[model samples]
Target: MLKIFQDLRELPKEEQKRSNIRNIIAGFILIITLLIIMGFTTLGGVNTFFETLRHYSETGELLISLDRARLYEQTFEKENSLNSADKAQQSIDQSIKLANTWNTNKNPP
Candidate 1:
């Protein structure tokens, strides 16, 4: 092993430069992986979940902004509106009500 390292030390300038870059890149990748592992372990899964949720909320807000802009462009007017998820929730609530009604009638209690 010592002889092999000694042979590597005597390599040409370009090869030595490549070796240094290879070592640097490998070390950088390893350090990044270790940091990520430490972060996830220290934050815990629940904390990660909440952090992910926070990111999702930000994305949702961006989507809502785009929708609002599109709506404005189509109408050439501004109007207040609920977010898309709120509209979806309203639809879901209506569907649940209809389902419950059907279930109640079918039972005929």
Candidate 2:
């Protein structure tokens, strides 16, 4: 270790300058490499976030449209069944009465 220190102290002036330049260059390269990797990592996370938002928006729009379509379909069905309206209403009334009777008779509190 003493010999190594002595040799470093005896090194040529031009060689010392070159060594300093090399160290500076290596340090700059390492910093730039880290910045590039961080940039890419941030870009990837941003892309994934936007992708998830896009899919969520599309899914919400699809569900809303489906709900509207179902509502229109049910409306159309009721309108087209006008000829059998009275019979349908009577059947619904009878079913409600039956359900009420069962509820009142079974496990009543």
Candidate 3:
């Protein structure tokens, strides 16, 4: 290997240029191969900022729906106690806030 490397270094300029071009092509091939492998293995699945934002909004909507359902169930319960009504109101309020937050463009602090 050492002898081969020395021989390469002693080659003519034209040969060295060919070697350089070959090495560049090999490097590009290696990078593309690694990217393909990563894609197949899902290792290159980094989320973009927009994707993260979309997921966050989706989660918020789901939570709001669940809260609204709980509030509705509480309102229809047999007891119909004042405490339950208050709790239900709180849940509805939280759900509304969550929905508004999702609709707004401002980032959360």
Best by TM-score: 2
Off by over 4 Å in 1: 1-11, 45-109
Candidate 1's clash total is 0
Using TM-score as the measure, what is the rank order of every candidate, best first?
2, 3, 1
**For model 1, how does the per-residue alpha-carbon lDDT over 1-109 read when each residue is reduced to its tens digit?**
9999887777777687999999999999999999999988987977879867866665555556556545544443333344544554555555556556545644668
- The deviation in Å at residue 47 for candidate 3 is 4.7
| Residue 61 Cα positional deviation in candidate 2, in Å, after optimal superposition | 1.4
The CA-based lDDT of model 1 is what? 0.66
In order, candidate lDDTs are 0.66, 0.69, 0.74
**TM-scores across all candidates?**
0.32, 0.47, 0.43
Residue 27 displacement (Å), model 1: 0.2
lDDT by residue for model 2 over 1-109, one digit each (tens)? Answer: 9999888787887698999999999999999999999999999999999967866665555555555555555655778665355544554555556556545544467
User: If both were scored by lDDT, which would come out higher, candidate 1 or candidate 3?
Assistant: 3
Ranking by lDDT: 3, 2, 1
Q: Best lDDT goes to which candidate?
A: 3
Clash pairs (backbone) in predicted model 3: none
When summed lDDT is taken over every stretch of 10 residues in candidate 1, the lowest stretch is 72-81
